[model samples]
Target: MKYFLWLLVSVALAGSISSCRSTKRIQTAISKKDTAAVVPVVDAKADSMRFIHEIYQAIERNRIDFNTFSAKLKVDFSGDEGKKRDFTAVLRIKKDSAIWVSITALLGIEAFRIMVTPDSVKVLNKLDKVIQLRSVSYLQELAKVPFTFQELQALLIGNPVFLDSNIVSYRKNEKTISLLSATDIFKHLLTVSTDDYRLLHSKLDDVDVLRARTCNIVYGDYVNKNALLFPTYRGITVSEKTKVDIVMQFKQVDFNVDLTFPFNIPRNYKRQ
Candidate 1:
């Protein structure tokens, strides 16, 4: 009876836990009519500013209930030009709250999954046929993700991605706002093109090297479904003395999808 209950719950959360956002609303927002209206305006800069503010205000005002998302990633680090290390992987994010959900990454010949709730985290590796579970606070230290949960949530919600928002500083002008956030880990400045609200450039200060590097993170396409905008392509280039470039092309994403925790282990699967 317990096994049956667990299956029923997992099925509800995992099936169609995937959904695409609504694109029609985005068409309405950026319609040809809106663009046409701006062509004749004299205070064109002001008008564009207002329009972008309204758009971003809408984005900020809007709420996201992103229960699940799918992403494809291509990561490359280029301190050395002699070799290029690359891999293709798909990841599924399932979250019920700020402290709960699952992340499953599928790579060639291996399946790695992590389930984190308020209390505990469980990592499952199908290739090794082992399951490891531990307390949440302890697991946070063990996590190897490039960013923290807060950062991930921000990215997932289509908001400005910052490693630390609490200490960020900002300066605004008619055309742009330069924001700087610093920590012992790293420091960076972000310039947002006011008319577009798109980040024009981001620069990170390298403490050890006693220098600065400009970072380029570009948004390629956004798909809007059900009042949410999702970026489909992302490219980032790190400019030090040398340049390292990485690009990610997303195949699909579903937000506000179902996510539930599993309550039972299959008899065949090993638990550790």
Candidate 2:
């Protein structure tokens, strides 16, 4: 069950190639014709810089701003050991303040309730009748990254994470634009829609050459709520020495709504 909580946090935490070919005959003809024709020298660097600026502007334009967020979602999790679990999770977030989650098992029985703040983390395991409390640093230890409450909030809210200004390369097609950025911690490859720049996918790899940590997150099924484009479906995979996959489908979602996070530890529950 503790592992499940880790997966949940990781879920909040966590691309294609194309080739073009030219025929030999076409290449030969172009070579002969271009002998007399002066080819225009394209400034590749300037074009790339312009495109990167446009991408940055588009991302800012589509960024979602909300006071509160609430969602009821179905979570399916699979671990490296071939264990699979499906459950319902209700999540509520008061932006930049607190995040509350309740997970329900079969027959809608409450299994675990979690509340996280900027400074602390609390977990109530109903099945085991135990409560675990730890500092926010515990999440960083588990995630193997400098984790923070703001990062978690961005993940849950479907905002970009680990994005760097130093975008080294980019690829664009008719449907999507992919940007690759390198940082001290991660090499983040983020893909977005060509039309509106909504986030489509994100891939993260550890910058350390020896570390084998990677994560992939895909966003889809976008719906417009209160003029905000919200992704209702998310698929996440995290791999290190082992792999864990999680799929989340939002059954219901609302933004800027009144919310209450009721959490009370039972007297009989043991503290761990």
Candidate 3:
């Protein structure tokens, strides 16, 4: 139960290869911001190799090129036991630097403040006045995902988080490209838009099959921010021993913006 919010925080915490000639050219087009709302022309007779190239190009095009990002989000969460809650959250990310979040509940009271970096994770429970300082491994244990801070940042920013470069199989349809990979512990499915290569959805299921643990994420509402497309809305669902669903909508978004990360544990606060 103590790990509940970490899973949610991981969502808020905010890949791959090549193909043939035409696909390389398409990447150049995307980087130049020439293809606004342009969907690539899918070849009906394309083979797995060609399709792989196209998929990689699209994935590359969707990568967010930003030094810093800050957003005010409306966060809603629900659980399998019919519990619901809402909080106003401020999310700040410095590319490859850190992710800082402040969650406010009733009357604008800050209930929790968390800061995660490449090396450590810090959480201050304002309600209990307890501070939890943990190593990055603690988070890996809590979430049961072999992810780094960079991976969480990618997830929050609507980018592909964990895609196996050596894909076993893939399916390409009119609107989406789906890639699949199987490991001993988890099976991963990543789906991206056929048009812009923006990630449309991602899912991870426990290989235990009988245990029924999974994490699903969906990205939507792409908005152009200085010629770069970013998702304005995100939905994450994780089902394990406990079920948690989180939805985040960016009310205001800014990029390459000057930001301050303020995290001060109170002097009287006890460390947990």
Candidate 4:
């Protein structure tokens, strides 16, 4: 049951966000879009700014500024022990504060509970009757990559994560817009819908040829939540030494409603 519960944690919050630069030219180009030609203009400065504006606008559109978020999810897990399993999870989050998750297994049995804050993380393993307390670095250890609490929260709320604002070039098509950036270790690519600017996909690959690894996340089935559009379904695949695929479907979601986060460990439970 420890392995089973850890799978939920690893998949739920294993990624991080990346950071951006110039504003004058970009702002001028954005303001001139009304007068610019419609037939795919060849001006490099104008086009680059246009692409940047599109991505920037999309990120803003997908942003969720709620004080609290609570959702019920139907999660399907694969690539763990080469077997598949389904679990129901209730996720509660307070913006920039903490994240609380409860996983229910067969027969609605509560198997695991997780609480993560800016400074620490706590896991209650009901099956083993043990609990683990660790610092924020626990996420980095679990994913074998640098990640933060806010990045995980952004991903959960369907906002853009791990995006680089230093994008100077882009590829555009009728259906999608692609942005690329290279870091010391990874080359990242992000694609979005040209129609509504919703995030379609994001891919990251190790730059070194000797080290082959990739992480891909896809968002779909967008729906409106109080004038804000959010993805209802998300698929995440991480390929490193091994491959893990996680599918999440949000059955219900509520934002900024009164809620409580309860976490209590039994006295008899052991600590590890």
How accurate locally, in lDDT, is each candidate? 0.43, 0.75, 0.69, 0.68
Which scores higher on TM-score, 2 or 4? 2
Per-residue accuracy of model 1 over 1-272 as CA lDDT, tens digit each: 11111111111100000122222221132222322112222231555456445544543444355666655554332332644444454555665333322323344453555554546656665666777666645433432213344444444344455434423344456876555556654455444555545433333444344434334444446677666656565444444455444444565566656645453445566777
**Candidate ordering by TM-score (highest first):** 2, 4, 3, 1
Q: How far is 244's C-alpha from truth in model 4 (Å)?
A: 1.2
TM-score of each: 0.51, 0.86, 0.81, 0.82
Pairs of colliding residues, candidate 2: none
Per-prediction tally of clashes = 4, 0, 3, 2
Off-target runs (Cα >4 Å) in candidate 2 are 12-44
Pairs that collide, model 1: 21-225, 22-224, 22-225, 22-226
Query: What ranking emerges by lDDT with the best candidate at the front?
Result: 2, 3, 4, 1
Using TM-score as the measure, the top candidate is 2
Q: On residues 1-272, what C-alpha lDDT tens digit does candidate 2 reach at each position? A: 56655765665444221111122211132122221112222233777888887897789778889999999988777778888878888999999999999988888899999999999999999999999999998888788788888888888888887766787777777998877776777777777989889998777777664766677677778899989999887777776778777777886889998999999998999999
Question: Model 1, which residues run further than 4 Å from truth?
Answer: 1-90, 94-110, 117-121, 134-147, 163-177, 183-185, 196-218, 236-246, 259-272
Winner of 1 and 3 under TM-score: 3
Provide the global lDDT of candidate 4 against the true structure. Answer: 0.68
Q: Per-residue lDDT for 24-106 in model 4, tens only? A: 21112212221111223323377578767767667676677888989998876666367777788999999999899998978
What is the Å distance of residue 52 in model 3 from its true position? 1.0
What value of lDDT does candidate 1 attain over all alpha carbons?
A: 0.43
Write out the backbone clash pairs for model 3.
14-152, 14-153, 19-53
